[model samples]
Target: MKPYLMIALCCGLYAGLVAAVEPITVAWRDKAPYHYRENGIEQGFLLRRAKHIFALAEVPAVFVERPSKRIWRDFERGKSSYCSIGWYRLAERERIAQFSVPFHVDPPHMLLVSPGARATVQAHKGVATLLQDGRISVGVVDGVSYGPALDRLIAGSANQVERVTVAPASLMQMVAANRMDYMFADEADWEYLRRHEEGLDAIVEQRFADMPAGLERYIVCSKDVPAQVMTRINRAIGALSDAAPGD
Candidate 1:
C-alpha cells in the first residue's frame, strides 16, 4: 500500500480500537419512564439523561437488562460493570455503590391497589396505618427501595406485605390478576403500564403523604469503576442543562 494509505489504515484501526474499548456495562431494569421500551427503543427521562451524562464522560457503554432484584444481583455478581438511571439514594445502596448526585427527585412511591381493593386501602388512614391494620396484603418488588421511611414501614410490617422478584410488567399483572393486593409504584411506571397492561385500568392510585420526601434517583456504579470516571460522570451530571425535574 502507498505510504498515505498505510497511515490512513492505521488511523482507522486506532479509531476502531478506541471505540471498542470495554464499555461500562450499565444494568437497566425495565421500569419506565426511568428506563423502558418505547416504540421498540430505550427511552425515559432518566435513561435519556444518563445517555447524555455517559457521552459527556466520554466512555463507551453497553446495557444489560433484567428484573429489578436481578438487576441488583447481577450488578453485584459482575454481570454488569455498573448501573445507570433511577436508583434511589438508599443507605444500603450507598454502602456498595458510588452514586452521582441527584439526577431527579421522582414522585414518591404511591399506593397502587386494584379497583375492588380501593375500599380496603381507603378505609385505613394512610399507608402506614393500612399496613399496621393488616387487613390487606401489600405487594412490593423484592429489590426496590421505597425510600427510607417507607422501607421502615414495610420492614415493620413484613408479614402484611409480600415481596416478589419480578419485572414491572409482571408486578402489574399480579395486581390485575388479584394475586397480590397492592404494590408500591411510581407515577411513571404506572403510566407506562396503563398503556400496555390490559387490566392496569383497574389499578387505583392513592398517596403516601406520611412518607418522607427526597425520593431522588442517582446514577449508581459498582465499586470497581475508576475514581476518575466517576468524577467525570458526576461532573457531567452536574453540568447537564436539561435535568429531569424533581418532585
Candidate 2:
C-alpha cells in the first residue's frame, strides 16, 4: 500500500473505533407531568432532566416507553441503566439503587376526597376511624409502588380500611361514583388528572394545606451501575438545581 493510503486507513479505523460505542438507553412511562409523550416526543420535567443528565455526561441516550411497574422491575432486575425520578430515599431502596442528588423537593402530597367525605374522615382521627365510621372506601392505583409510608398504612390498617385498586385514570371514576371515598397521590399527578380528564375538576376536593412535606424526587439507577456514572449524574443534577422550577 502507498504510505499516504496507509495513514488514511489508520485514521479512518481510529474514527470508527470512537464511533462504535453504544448510547445508553433510558426508560420512561406515560404518566403525565413526569414522563410522557407529547407530539411524538418524550417530554416532561423529569424527562427533560434525564436528557440533560445524559448531555452532561456526554453520553448519547435513547428514551423508550415501559409501564411504570415494568420499569421499576427492570431496574430491580438490573435489566436497564435508567429509572425515573425517585420521590424519596427509603432505607430499603437505598440498598438496591444508587440515587443522584435530589433535584426537586415536591410539595406536600395532596389528599383528594369525594365531596362531603373530608370532614367526616378527618374527624375520626385515623384511616380505620374514617373507614369504619364513615364507611369510606380508600383507593390506591393498581400496580403503583407504595413507599414505606403507605406500606405501613396498609399493614396496620388493611382490615379496617376498604382498599380498592383502580387504574390511575379510573381512580377518579371510582371516587366520583362514591365507590371510593378518597384518592391520594402526588399533587402533580392530581393536577395532571384535572387537566386531562374533564368533569374531574368538580368531583374531587383537594386538601393541600394540611399535608406533610413531600418526598424529594431524584434520578436513580441500580446500585450495581458504575460509581462514575452515578457521580456524573449527581454532579449534573447539582449543576441543574438553579434551573429547576419552583415548587
Candidate 3:
C-alpha cells in the first residue's frame, strides 16, 4: 500500500480518469423557504441550489442539520469541515469563514409587529427612529445579523430591544403573543412564517426607512475548506445561472 496505489484505487472506484474530490460537509439551520427539513428531507431554495451546484461540479457534499448557534460556532472554528448554504457576507462572518459566490439575493430587512403595535411603529420613520425614541421593545434573534444600520442602532441602544434566543419562527410567535413588540425579518423569511404561524394576521410589515438592503448571500464555507472546492462550487453556480434563461 503505497502513494500511487491509493490514487490508482480511488480513480478506479470513481471510474475513467476522474479524481476523487474531498467531501465538503455543507450544514445549515432550519430557515424555511431557504433551508429546512420537510418530512426528514433537506429542502429549500438555497439547499436545492447548493445540491445542484455540488452535483454539477462533481463535488461530494455531506449535509448536516443544526440550530443557528451551532452553525455559527462550527462555521467559525474552521477545523470541522462544515459549510453553510446561505449566509450573508457580514464583516464579522467574513473574518472567520470563506464565502462562495452568491446563490440567493433577498430583499431588505423589514420590521414585523403585531397589528396592535402598528400604530406605535408607524409613528416612527424606521427602526433607527424607534431606537432613538427609546419607546418600543423590538425583538431580535440572538445569533442572526440584521444588516448594518439596525445592528449599529440596536447595539448602541441595547435596552430598546428584546433578544430572543430562539428560532426565527418563535420570534414571530412572541410578537403575536405581545411578548415582543416587534422583530426584524427579511421579506422571504417573514412571508414563509406569516402563512404558517398562529395568530399571524396580527403581524405587520414595516419597510425600512433607515437603510438600504445589502449584498446577496454567499455559500459560507469554513476557511479550512480547500480553495479549489469553492472555485468549483462557484463555477457550478455560474453554470446554473447561465442555463436558466434558455430552459
Candidate 4:
C-alpha cells in the first residue's frame, strides 16, 4: 500500500473504534429549571448544557430519568460508563465518583416558609438564629446536601427536622401544607414552582443574610468511567462559554 493510503486506512480504523464505544448513561432527577420532564419530553437548562457538552466532545450519551437516590447508588456500585448531571462537588461524593469541571452555579438557597410559620421565620434576622430555634421545624430531603455551610448548621442545630425522600416540588407542597415550618430551596426552583405550581402562594419565600454563596454544580460519573472519556467531557465543559439559548 502507498504511504498516504496506509495513513488514511489507520485513521479510518481509529475513527471506527471511537464510534464503537458504548454510550454513557446520563442520569437526572426531577428538578425544574435544572433537569425535569415536561409533557413527556426532557427539558431544563442543565439538561440542554449536558447535551451540548457531550455533542462537543463527540461522545455518545443517553440521558435517563432516575431517582436521585438511585443515581448515587449506581455511582457507589462503580457502574461503568454512568454519569449524572448537576451534582454538587463534595468530599464524600468525590470518594464515590469523578467530577468534571464545574459547569453550573446556583444562587444561594432561601427558606420556603409555611404560612403558619411565616411570623416565626421572619422574626429571625439570620438563618443560624432560625435554625437554632427549637420551636421551629425544618423539612429536608434525605441524602441531599444544602451546600456544606447549611449542612453543618443543620447538623449542629437543636431544631426538629423532618427528612423525606421526595422531589423538591412535592417538598414545597409539604411546606404549603404546614407539615414543616420551612425548607431550604434554590431561588431558581422557587421561581419555577411559583409559576407552575398552584398553592405555592401559601409558602412564603424568604432569604437569609447568613446564607452561603452559591455552590457550583458539576457532572459526576461513576469511578469506573474511563479517564479519557472524563477528559473529553471536561474539555467540552471548559470550551463552552454560554450554554443557554434565547427563547
Q: Which tens-of-lDDT digit does each residue in 77-163 have in candidate 2?
A: 776455555446777567667777887777765566767566655665544344344355567775454555655655555333545
> Candidate 4 lDDT, tens digit per residue, 102-183?
9888888988999999999999999988888999999998888998988999999878989999878899999999999999
Ranking by TM-score: 4, 3, 2, 1
Q: How close is candidate 3 to the true structure, as a TM-score?
A: 0.83
Better of 1 and 4 by lDDT: 4
Task: Give the whole-model CA lDDT for all candidates, comma-separated.
Answer: 0.75, 0.66, 0.77, 0.89
Q: Better model by TM-score, 3 or 4?
A: 4
Which numbered prediction scores highest in TM-score against the true structure? 4
Clashes of each: 0, 0, 0, 0
* TM-score, per-candidate, Cα-based: 0.76, 0.77, 0.83, 0.87
What tens-digit string does per-residue lDDT give for candidate 3 at 84-158? 878777888888888888877777777787767789878877656676656678888886777666677778864
Q: Per-residue lDDT for 1-247 in model 1, tens only? A: 9999999999999997875576887777777767778788987767777787888878778775666677677656754366656787776666777787777776667767866688877887766677776668878888667778878878898336777888767888888777877888877777777886786777778886775564878888888787887888888878784554431
Cα deviation at 69, candidate 2, in Å, is 2.5
Runs in model 4 with CA error above 4 Å? 1-20, 242-247
Quote the RMSD, in angstroms, for model 4.
3.8
Report the poorest 10 consecutive residues by lDDT, candidate 2.
Answer: 125-134
